[model samples]
Target: MLDNIEADFPEYAPRRPGAPKALDGIRVVDFSHFIAGPFATMILADMGAEVIKIEAPGPGDDLRRYPPVHPDLKHGAPFVWTNRNKRSVALDLKMPEGVAVARDLIATADVVVENFSTGVMERFGLDYEACRKIRPDIIYCSVSAYGREGAFADRLGFDPIAQVESGFVSMNGYADREGVRALSPVMDISTAMMACNAILGALVARERSGLGQAIEVSLFDSAVLMTGYATMQHLFSGANPQRHGNTSPDTCPSGVFRAQDCTFYINCGNDKIFQRLMAQVIDRADLAEAEIYATGPDRIRRRDELFAILGEAFARQPWSYWQARMRVAGVPCGQVRTVGEAIRSPEARERGIVTRIPHEKLGWIPNVTLPIRYSGTPIVDPVAAPAVGQHTESVLRELLGYDDSRLGRLASAGVFGADAARRPRQDAKV
Candidate 1:
């Protein structure tokens, strides 16, 4: 078995010289895959929780296979995006020994996160009920397409389905074409945020009550919220929302516009912003003074004429010129940049939104940190995402207090994987 984990995960740096992280003492056993559950646990990891990701001996999380793949890393960009600062423990859960080792980890974990299909955990004998028996105060979280019970619990779901079912897709796209699901996994992203908040709340409650509870966050439920007030308006007005394309149904002069050289977006949320845009940015003082465009309601009533005028004016200038004018005028506007441009923008680099971090084999790779800022409990400096089963020997020996003999026994039983056979046998517990 692998005795030295440093060879497996040279990028796995667990600690740095810092003040203190909010979750310094917390330990999380992450069984989540893809986006939501992993995302939630990644937030916790950012807060300094020790996240132990249990992956199967072979392929590991499916996200590791997503593109654009790194040639040397084996895992892809999507996997690295969320799985950073986590330690990977390879275990073949199909084997009884694997299940036993998983239970051992859960017994010591403060939080357990899973996004497997309903009843899969139960079948593995690692369900919340089974886990709670090992550690009664364990905060268990299950992320799913739907709730774990009821009529639709068995149904599998992805971000697109959630958007469709929750009315999110219906609210997007132009009214003429069929409604389109957002290219981004907005539902999944929102669900991750919800699950993160729920887990944090559970942790707070546990502090006072010394008790743990289970949390369930579903993509369908969060996707509805992602639709914003459309659901509420439907209840009140008893009418379904029609897709409005890039334009907002509630606000005028709030959509994409083309400049001489580039596309840009503008949002005149209220009459005041509209006035500023006309008077300062576009220098249309007469239009700013017009009674028909003085209020938000009036502007909405005449959005077509207003858009036509604005489009003509914007077309005369390049994006940079309009952006500078809008900045001075306090108009909410930005260039409609591609993903690569957005990440490499000067502002993003200055703010450390996207920066380079050292990797084991790759030397350096781009890293995107969480957006949150804290004055006291600062986030930990991130480490690169772990390789599958990279920390198996270390975690088994250090965290689980298993010695060389035990690890060897588990390895011999085909618990770890085919790769496990290559790891040198540990002489003794670390």
Candidate 2:
């Protein structure tokens, strides 16, 4: 399925033969799964950190089984999107031998990230304190729903739950209907970005102080901040934000509108933009000069009347007609496009936002690159997400200097799970 899509789309391969990377010498031992944790580690990986992802022996990360699964890859699109530029090592953490190997790996890592429930890492003896014992200057990061400590530590939370609890869901959608949660996991994505930023900051601090610390990022806390300026507004006014749908409560002439052929949106942020919209785009100088439409507050007071006039005027022209004029007028406007349309739009193509990268089994698969640009240091080349335990043998051999004899012994002891124990010794080859 992915192969077909890549075949029709443009292929992208960044060319920078020997450029330095931002995080060239760093190594991260990633025990994170799902969106928040894995995504944070992926950002580090993109910046040239060697990220070693630890997963369970059989199923691996739960996100691997998410929808739109690839038959050959086994994992789904969500996992592929976040796990690039990383190696995967599957181990049975239930076994003492597996924990020993993890400790050995930790000793060689600069960063350790995990997002298991409050005490899961402590049970495996891989928590922040345990990791600090292995390597004193290790930067340990924990991503959780609430926090690793506190009364809500035991509570399980997801993106929708965080949105509802943090008032994010209360300030979206139309006022007439119940507020709706974002279809995208905004809370999870925002938390991941925050975790990445925190880790980067800790790395800088450690470079000067020669000390490591534990950092925590919570979904609820990030969601609350994701409410943007509304939180501050509520504090100042003591009034909660109301749902405004596509319209802006503070700005006049800022909402979805319909052109003759299709739907578009226009935002006249100030009086000048509104004047330009009237005199330049729609050619309504009478309305532009009228006292009722002179100021933002005045226009807002007669919003229904003004919008009705704009609506009738807009219905006379197609989206293309208004878009070109708006471009010249400097008015912020765009066609209300679907996900597919937006991805394939002319602007997206110009920005190279979506492209295809090579994959081992699939020949080539779709890849969405990070939106970062560096003059001296470039991000690492994209690599497809690894299959479960794909690098178990290689990681043990290279990082820990484990010999074939020791690997065989650990396998026999069920350190790599029963299925691995039953496989031929040569199958452990890197």
Candidate 3:
């Protein structure tokens, strides 16, 4: 397993020791789980917001139990990937005391994020209107399958469902077979990014007007947007996109090809790039200057023939040989790599995209940092995702000023579930 790998991997370090972070002084009460909501809040947490993740008392977030669980961490790999730089607080929202405690936290928070079904928050009295009563300037964001007030709001949806419903699946895979959904949770991830962007915009607006507003991001809506310019093209041409496998419908000679030693992808986005690929990289000026392949449309009309010729030429050399020639010719190309290969590639290492971070029990664990860079304000140094309810006592003590006696009373009332509330207070930390 990657977690067990021992090597001289670089350790994560603070970019600016004493400098302020972009979202410093911000506090977010995150009632989200799984990918979309948690990922959005994780981005906020990465930017230095104090994100308090509110999970259910017993099982907590479902992602915590996802496959490939780490023994020492007691959480799955996916949970660790998205929940870093945040505090966990387990609360039984079914109990009134738990709801009261949640309201108390909201009063002290600048933002609230949730991904529950339509009426779940309202049932717990944590909806936007209710939260606004607690903190009028709160930036409340909701992530759902559909619009919160729409007819389809009650419909349950996940990444694959959204992909199919939004026409994303229809535009992918090979033309000869049924369209295939992307294995990755592209819809969920893109929805998270949209939610984060919306929240950031809301924060900026709040700073200007001293007012906060409700923000909604839906997986279905985000999935539709993820279809890219294809939607616009469909509107303009009155036609839906057809699956073309690795090859592009708009460009010729833009797809997967095999070199002598490896497979690679090349994208000739325009005529000039195609010209460069044939004339300079492959040393085929005849093909480059041929009238049959002069323009994008012309080449696209003869895509199969061009691809066959290019394939033969690429197969004559190893990836390194073709890669070097393509680099000199200024052609855009890359080797098709697996996830493991890409993560450990020279590019990933040189950019410091992956590193090891200290873990209380595991010594160190792999960490993937965000791609953002700022000259003035840098991202926060990542902290491992907390154990279940890891900061319940400390957060209650510091934020709500609850003493041991009060905590004991709440625990006795079943506010923090069976095991969590019974745990020794000293075991929980901030």
Candidate 4:
């Protein structure tokens, strides 16, 4: 059945034709461990950057042990999602030799990204200053929970914590209920996007000035920035926005409404769209003409009644019916898809958003393709995330030109371990 389509449809044939890609030859030395920093580097990697991920010797990144580990995978899904399309090298940066090797890698890299807590890199003597000394044209990006010199610099933070501290949590969920914190890693991913933007901007600047600069992005700052429009409303208009539960505070009919079997979101932001939606999609011309529902503010003032009317109308039909009607009416609407549904959706599959790459241990794993699509250059298939110390010997010998004796000495001293495959074949080489 599948062969029939490939044989008949030339456009949809399984021909390995090369297409246009964007990014070509950039190199990134990723020193980041967790989601935010690594995510940024992953985007760059997808844009065709040669991203080398440097991890510590022991246990590797903590994310490797995170939950939802596929039965055949050593690391969890989150780790795989954040760390595809990169090379891994384990180093004991606390040692002088290890730090030296890292410095050499930086010397050959175009960008350096790290999200360590404030002063960790400085303590290790691998901060921006040190890297810049080796490569004056390096784009150094420091991502943290807070800025390095800020009052909250030393305090640890994650996505939810930043959401609370940055006022995002206060504006979410129900009006009558307490503010509900988002379980999604919005702050982490948003901060990653911001960091990526800064790094790309710095790269552009470096092209002009023939020099590099250090850039900083923090989750706290990004979370606050995401709340800009809402914050300004509070400041300029003296309106304390309350949790309205799935609805936009400034726009009416901009929230989830239920149907017979599913829920969908409809965003009627402008009066014209609202009128069109009412007349075409709902066939409610009288409701559109009512003075209480005519203007934007009037709709907000009578939001409860409007919601009741809309909700009842929507409840009368199945979600698919409303979706088709709304599509024809040019109203912005979408069904709320679960993670599995969205990933396996026809549109997602057609766009190649979900791709399969083979792993040594796991036969094939699904990796979400990077969203950026280029016309001239595209991301190549990346090496799977390494097992602990997977390339220890190869990295040391190739990067530093270490001999067998030097590599043996390092293994004996516990500075670095040999490859996993060689461990059972021989004792410590040193």
Candidate 5:
């Protein structure tokens, strides 16, 4: 797979001046795997940073083995999706030469990202203290299950664990059954976003103070934030938030309901929306003006009766009929859609959210462009994810200016395996 790893992306050329890129000369040493840290670095790479991903020898990042693997790619879809525009350097930190080389890379790096368990970086001599000694003003970010200083820092964690422990899972699903965890790793992904924001903030501060600092983002902390303002509400009311399934606990008529054909959701978040829904969509002006349902709180108090009345009206028509009526009534509503359906919807196409990009081997593959849009200095053209140690020799030759003989000695000692001896090609562009 490493031997056949390829790229055929269009060469990026700015169409206008002053588009040097947001992180034109920034260098990031990425020592992360799986979701969080790798994703954070990928965002930086998308902004034109040079990201060097240091992976363990052998199969490298575990995300490479995830299911739904890309037929023509070395890593699976998740890995490829998050790791594009980064260089892969297979290194065995267990070996002294590998550790020495990693330290050398960190010595000149402007930023470093790691998501290993607590103390793992320290064991490899790549911790914040060691990195600071090499480059005193280097931005270093650490991602973990819990933070580094907490009592639970030693305990391992993942997205699901964070979700359950942070009250996220408790607030989901129906009150009757067990709350289900989100199938996707929401906590890990959101934590990565937080980490990226922190890294950007650090970069901005470095420009002002000429000093870099350490940043810590964890799945646990981010998961709690994902719980929204439920914690604050609970503290004030001293009441636990009940699981509402598809409905909003604080809003009336905001739940899933089946039309004659398919299921749909209605969100009458305010009294005006509820009145519009009742008068225009359901043709029941009496309900809209009734004292029992005139206000949001009153509607919530009599939700059962209101839902029964709306359900009967909605059941008389198909989802499309109710959708159109709600749209004209100024009521927020949507048809329930599967993941695949949502991706292929007309709105998604109109917005260009889902697109097919040129792939070297497959010819074209679907890519999801991020929601972020910049009027200037747009994201760099993307490249396919790299194989294990795909850029190892090139990185050494270019960044450290190591000749073939030095690379051979390192490979001879199992610093990056015998594959490191492969000739570096000019086409190995991140």
Candidate 6:
């Protein structure tokens, strides 16, 4: 078992103090909640941005109380996963004092990220214009389900809705059934990536312009972008793609098939690869020379026949056998592992994708490291996700120079209430 990084890698400063990370020293005020917005900001935080997440005064982010709450963290697993490396400050933005404090924070921030419905920020007086007034070089990132303008601007949209509206759902699954939404939040994750990309681009542009810009990203746009080849086919050939289950219309023998012990996917994308796969894995040199399967189109045309032959061959051996043989032949192949399997697999462990970190309360809890790698400045080892307003007093003192009396006054005024109180030291209970 791997020990906590802080203990094991004592000399590792992950990123050197003077050395700049990809977004080192950048300040971000994150107002987004739930997955998409938080996910994007999480990436920024991992890259060394100082992200301060403002949450509601009471329960804070909804995910805090979401089900599967960890006994030690008292928050959902998903929430902890997305919010590490961020400072949590609970505030009732509805209050005048809270709003004033927020303005002060924004005044010193390089970016403001929010995903409230189209004009909610404007109504709250935290819109781009307001931020620009305080800090001329502020990057205001507004994430929405649809967009800032147009008919659906105010309409509610989620990952599934984006998939349906953008024609992405139509390209999934088999034709026998109505195309289904992906089990995972594909659109949300993609939108997060796009939003991060946009922020990075704006940061680069700002370096030269000495000004800031308002950035917009929508779930619909990300969904449409994800339909790369599907959109291309429709645009160039006037063809509507059908849902082909576990097989590709463009490439035959490129999907899952059953082995004696398990199932696996094999991609014989082109004729040359198919020939190699046949000769190497199937031990069928004669099959490669067969006229009917000489080219991609020909193999695609005879997909059923080809599938029948390949299927029988694959079923003769177990998944591990084929996985090794196919990989050795330089073909792209892998076993269809479950989520649990994938997480614990040797490849994932070796890459340090999943790691154990010592949480204040949990002692040892698992965290997934940021996937991006930079030679000069890698992500800093994450601090444990905070309890509600865990850094309230410290942040107030350090950032705004608030003394004990001022903090007490604010607390008494309900700016910071019961939930903001320091948690009593406790043993691991999760």
TM-score of each: 0.93, 0.97, 0.98, 0.89, 0.93, 0.93
Residue 62's C-alpha lDDT in candidate 4? 81
As for candidate 5, its clashing pairs are: none
Please give, for residues 1-430, the per-residue lDDT of candidate 2 as tens digits.
7636764568886858989999999999999999999999999999999999999998999999998999999999999999999998989898888999999999999999999999999999999888999999999999999999889999888999999999999999999999999999999999999999999999999999999999999999999999999999999999999999998888899998999899999998999999999999999888878888889888878888888988999999889999999999999999999988888899988877788887767889887788887788978888888888888888998899999899999888878767778994333321
- How high is the CA lDDT of each candidate model? 0.87, 0.91, 0.91, 0.78, 0.85, 0.82
User: How well does model 4 score by local distance difference test?
Assistant: 0.78
For residues 1-430, could you state the per-residue lDDT of candidate 1 as single tens digits? 1123333223323344668899999999999999999988999999989999999888999999999777778889889999988998888888888999999999889999999999999999998899999999999999999899999999999999999999988888999998998998888789999999999999999999999999999999999898899889999999999988889888988999999999999999998898899999989999999998988788888989999999999999999999999999999998899986886677776666765567667666666889988778878888888888888888877888998789888887778887566566432111
Better of 1 and 3 by lDDT: 3
Q: List the residue pairs that clash in candidate 3.
A: none
Q: What tens-digit string does per-residue lDDT give for candidate 3 at 281-377?
A: 9999998999999998998889889889988888899999999999999899999999989988899989889889878788788888888887888
Candidate with more favorable, higher lDDT: 5 or 6: 5
Best by TM-score: 3
lDDT of 4 by residue, 276-336 (tens): 8889999999887777887888888888888898999999999889988988988999889
Clashes of 2: 0
* Clash tally, candidates in order: 3, 0, 0, 6, 0, 0
Clashing pairs in 4: 20-375, 21-375, 21-376, 21-377, 22-377, 408-430
Tens digits of lDDT, candidate 5, 102-170: 998998799999999999999988899989999999999999888999688998898999999999999
Pairwise lDDT winner, candidates 2 and 5 = 2
- Whole-model lDDT for model 3 versus the true structure? 0.91
State, as a TM-score between 0 and 1, how close model 6 is to the true structure.
0.93
Query: What is candidate 4's CA lDDT for residue 106?
Result: 86
Scored against the true structure, residue 88 in model 3 reaches a CA lDDT of 88
280: Cα error in model 1, Å: 1.6
Worst 10 residues of 3 by lDDT: 421-430
TM-score, candidate 2, is 0.97
Ranking according to lDDT, highest score first: 3, 2, 1, 5, 6, 4
